[model samples]
Target: MSRAEQPSRRTVLAAVAATAVAAPAVAGGAAPAVAAPGGSSASGATGESGSRRRRPAGQVDHRAWASFRDWRSGTAQGTRAVPGRRPGIAIAAPAGTLDYTDPHTGTTAPWEYAVWTSPVHRLAVPATEVIASWNAETPAGTWIQVELRGTYSDGTDTPWYVMGRWAAGDQDIRRTSVDGQGDGRSSVWTDTFAIDDAATGLRLVACRLRLTLHRRPGTGATPVVRRLGAMGSDIPDRFTVPASVPRLARELVVPRYSQEIHKGRYPEYDNGGEAWCSPTSSQMIIEYWGGRLTEEQLAWVDPSYDDPQVCHAARYTFDHEYAGCGNWPFNAAYAATFRGLQSVVTRLGSLTDLERLIAAGIPVITSQSFLEEELTGAGYGTSGHLMTVIGFTADGDVIANDPASPGNEAVRRVYRRREWENIWLRTKRYNASGKVVSGTGGVCYLYFPAHPSLRQRLALAAVGVR
Candidate 1:
């Protein structure tokens, strides 16, 4: 969907956590409904399915992906299977669907796909292979740029690999282009590095790497892209994650209605026209899980410390920026800490990183701008303000709790998802410091480049929460 439609998209997400899976749609021709490979019925399998599914070692699974066959079609449709020559094996059709099935759950959900081969022949990669391969032809007359960066044990000075070409013919990926030797820029180095692969027993700098694929602007043929998280040569088991549960919610401040005054009705004012538009939305998610800082009791906004104030200073503090308030720690910190918490706030830098986390079953929290007028209404306030919304109402309305409000009554405001998202456009708020802070003059988002150790801590904390 166009960026214009994110609000409507996120509204569906706000309430997914509480809702159960709807009954599966029976497709056109119902094959004799045999029990899925495992003795359990398809219905039964879904019962066992939580937000995530387990995968076997060494195999690549594509099921559970939120696929968009037609970029224009905002909503993802059911899977289409491409059967393999081998019995009980097939590649999912309808483009982008997975071809594998769960041996435990006989029923195969259309979204769950696996890439498999004839029982006799197979594709395998060593845990240490520095190459990648695909049967699909390279987009002819085009360049597919691959970047390699790994984190050495000390967790500093990560470097980019030397430029390499996807050589003419299809060959098993044997080696990575040599390291592009030079004192690389710190931003590139920090993002590309991985944790030491051999570390075990709670490594603070444990294994983590990011592989980004950019669609070369003038590539003649459509590039067929495949990625599964792995280090050097080992391909880690890839799985699909539903997008609804983990999401970003933006509390839009539109003009006229959501005003930004040099001196607004509230105290602790900035030179301001509203601020905290996106930060408010993000804080709602982070604090939702930690369950601190009730709405009625306003936390003190510390000018010195840019982060939120936890109930117990010992537990957490306003001094440090955290990834988000939600249980999902798909933030720059990867865990909740002063270290990496600052990195998760941007709409741009966090885009790809957030996508990878979401693909791995973590929800990302972000806000959208629907119309331009909403900002005027939400007056800019330096006073601490935040709320949490667990889900939506029966009529696709946003059901949220304003910690600023009273008990049980916390569930008062219900908004049309589109209406809420529409508000983002009017306000200009940037993410900065630990929380969303305002500019001396107008609103804008803030960004910071964090260290790898900070990110590792955040990731661990996020995963640990669930």
Candidate 2:
């Protein structure tokens, strides 16, 4: 019941999502599955069929397994579940070894490996798209690979798809997403698993994640995976989303550092500050939670750089193959590298979701693409960008710590609610040339303390990401 090993351990985990019922980490031996709101059949309206039709509230299903017991519930082969202040899974022994050639470096090396498979997860909401994210520490000699195997509504299983092969450091293996992978039914676009055509009445009904932990042969080193999970949703495809009423209009005071200042500083890391939005947003949240890099950690940066941590973040998060620091999961994983923090990459249904978390004092990082004319008051345009939603204005407008600014003092800006929502939530849009393109579809990254207060847990649960 296994694929032949080429070769690919850890004690890492993520938390429960807003609406994911804490069941056995996988399916079949845990809490009974809870259906998503309205529970539509798997083969219907992923998002395209009823573009204008009002859909049920809360369409996304988020699930993660981070508890020691949760890790023990999964199927393990040469893997061990470690229980402690933070529970996670780690390599027990090498079940096999495989030769991995760094496509970025064209160097081949053999690595010892172990496997841990989550129990089947029956999605309360059958989805057209799924994104998997993990929080782990892959030291100098170790890394991990995450893959998803899905079951369609018709009872067919998908070929296992590689979600990502990653490490905190690039020396071992360049963290990268596999390209040109698909089975004609589903395709992995960057970090996402998307139905090739959701409009065909096809949907992913259930899925399981397989974690492959890798380390240099004969080394005791092992990656510890502290958090791992996926968010699956069938969001409607629309250029515009209905306006949400203003709620909880208070902004959290978050430190801001503009990426613009670092422009051209290190062109190798995604062409420097002009494109360091993702890492900048991540560093803000990491510091907000009291995570700081020791002076020793910042020693490598040039002595003259201001806010050197920003530059450090940019370098650490740069995905060589993607050639950008904007890789969603990579940023989240980078945030988790800080002490006492865990992060996830999931989609939010509405601004209300952001409000709930903000009420509990959690800031959100959102991804969107827009033209200069689309988002009024913003002086620039970007094919894609990352901004931190620290709070809302009294009138419900978004108050974001945008990194694309002239200076840190000007990093925070108020964006029109309607324009912001449409740009971030829509799955389709038109480029400047009037050519149709894809939107971010409400994709966001959530970072919080490893142990949260009850109120924080409730808010995260309500928002469908814990």
Candidate 3:
């Protein structure tokens, strides 16, 4: 599970070579603005720092630590903030070592570790749920753990819950999300930390993230964390969300690769590619940003296989505990491992946010679930699925690169805007079995160049990412 370099497959990857983050940042002019969650216009707007707000902010609030200043702002114990094109924190010296028994494999080993705790960030929108994500590179003998502690509206604090214990390679440890973590009032549902009784009006008013970087005892190797953040939202519990009027007509020529093509290819990775919608969608957008796998890096794949990169993605992004490649942050962190790219997991208010990103030449990966009849033209349905939003048709319909297709040739699908939006942004839904279930609530992954264009940064800022 150790990657010297992760490989990827391609159907129509762009020829743009990866660029350096130090290359001149194009930022003198005003940041571009996206439609404020319900329209189609690419208009004028400012970043979070600007006094003239782009528009009313959405229900989701994303706060992450990435810049050198942001890294230095955090309280570090055995860690030191490393400054570079992308500022990060690393272990200057180990705080101590502890023996950890693998819950899944039952292998006990001693690991040197260091901790970094972020400054408390009060949520602009007090949320009933919060999901944390981080981007890091863990060497063969190293890994990292992310945890969250929050203060509820009543002023009581929640215990530190382990959000994830992750490694890029599974050689040292199996990447997993800890279960059975809760405080009578709230709980961790796999990757998300949620309030148990949101109807009581209890909400997460603020939270802090704790990052622990782990390495083998007596090794100089360490995990370097480039980005860490979380999304907190209080999406209304409803089967439907207010619909948006699509105003943009544009399409990005993103690559198309299907997860169905690799069904049963690697059963060890979450029962094979049949459930690889997350990684497949990630790989498509990664290639769209000029990220590619070299032949030498792809040496691990079976020569008889087609699109070995998809196989590679599925294997690397697979979460052992979840037994699937659908871990939202794991997929985002996987995409960030590529050269000159940064990725984050956040929520958008509506498809209008998507249109703004597409207009800025960046494609988005969205998570949604639907009944077979809820969506037209999609022959199958699932409790969850991921698709790449490449563009919009002249009629404002969503132009998506759905990896659930039968083959790469049928990957580009046009889903009605209303149907796609409702399925993606709603917080509640009814299953085919006539049971109430949870929806994605606008969760998505945004990947872009480390040094984005003026327009790209503006588009991102407009969506409250800066």
Candidate 4:
């Protein structure tokens, strides 16, 4: 469909605000229009470098393009900015192409190509070759990192360096220059690249660019950040998300804790059949494991009490008057609810996040005494029933601890990735915005300690864990 014909899929008022070369980027703000190339952005054209390039006008399959773009745009906004000074970036790809999924809603959507090409902030002749051109500052010194990504006919994706680079004394050119306009020190960088593939005639099909402030972290000191200050051009017509990169995290691990049906042998918090066993089981890992999870991720573990947006809380752990864990210790619901029985585990990108948590050697289990104290103090009941997490196998299998089961209190349950996700996703209850809950007040937050072990950091890198 033409950009104007594109229907609103998932998200609203978010497109072409930020962008890149062959990857993907949306507008930086809610401007009136998304910017596009002043000249034709068709497949066959001259690049910014003025090199004659002939690419398969059909390089990006049209249907696939729609799918990709729709998915990314519909997702919750990541880091974004209001239109101010920087020339808003734009996404360039074979029209109507983007294939990605919304990690939050579990919905599959496509991109709005024409909308992406339309600029929201300042307009660059062609959105692809140039994102935002501005100046920014850093602590070590001012540097730049122009975000760009692309894929070759051989299916090899371009590295971060392909879009731009940085060097010493010269102020990192890789960063988005925001201060070129003197007096006001903003930082922005120009994106420069040539489509060169003589063999297959495959010009750069898709390119996404991001103008980011590159901050060098300091030892025993907080890293400094540069904000986008000013813009050099007028906002464009529209904006969007071009799918030049796959949506795989550096490291993504789903750690399963305890599993129980609401109707199963568990105490119902509100006498509702829905069981809180699995949610309880997962909490152990969140508390124990260490990583940088978004607020949404944390909420998925322990939903809030009043408005369980993403997930539901079985009941208040400390409130004993109602059906609480303090009463049915032997029941499945009781085992999962007891804060004392809580044990944490790691679900990290590389085995490293896990290994680091293990190396910390902090006792993973809360002692039986600790459990009793929590229950009595919080007014939770305690039946004889107990739940345990035997451990996880190297290949990602759950070795669970079910005290109620015969002989095999701990057994390995091999579940397909699809089935596991299905079960977990189905239990999710949502608010209007679809955020996950964490506590009684409905407030949500995530914690990432600065002093993580080196092993944990290294492991996170391996899995592209952010």
Task: Name the top TM-score candidate.
Answer: 3
**How high is each candidate's TM-score?**
0.25, 0.86, 0.87, 0.22
**Which candidate gets the maximum lDDT versus the true structure?**
3
Candidate 1, residue 353: lDDT: 30
lDDT of each candidate versus the true structure: 0.24, 0.78, 0.79, 0.24
Q: In model 3, what lDDT does residue 46 have?
A: 27
lDDT of model 1, residue 101: 28
Tens-digit lDDT string for candidate 4 (38-132): 22111122333222222211111111111122223221212222232212222222123333232323444332221221112221222222222
lDDT of 2 by residue, 163-219 (tens): 888887676788887776777777776677887766678999888899999999999
lDDT of 3 by residue, 1-466 (tens): 2111111110001001101111210011111121112222122332332211223375888777777777777788789999876778998899999999888899999999999998887787899889898888776788999999999998999999999998877777888988768767777767778777676799998888999999998889888898888888888888988888887999999899999989888899977777788999998988887777766556788999999889888887888877778888888888877757778888998889999999999899998888878889888777778899999999999999999899999999999899999999987777665756677788899988766777887888878775
Residue 270, model 1: Cα distance from true site in angstroms = 10
Query: 26, model 2: CA deviation in Å?
Result: 29
Candidate 2 positional error at 380, Å:
1.0
> Model 3 scores what on Cα lDDT?
0.79
Least accurate 10 contiguous residues by lDDT in model 1 = 23-32
Residue-level lDDT tens digits of model 1 in 220-277: 2232222112222222211211122224333322111111111122222211212322
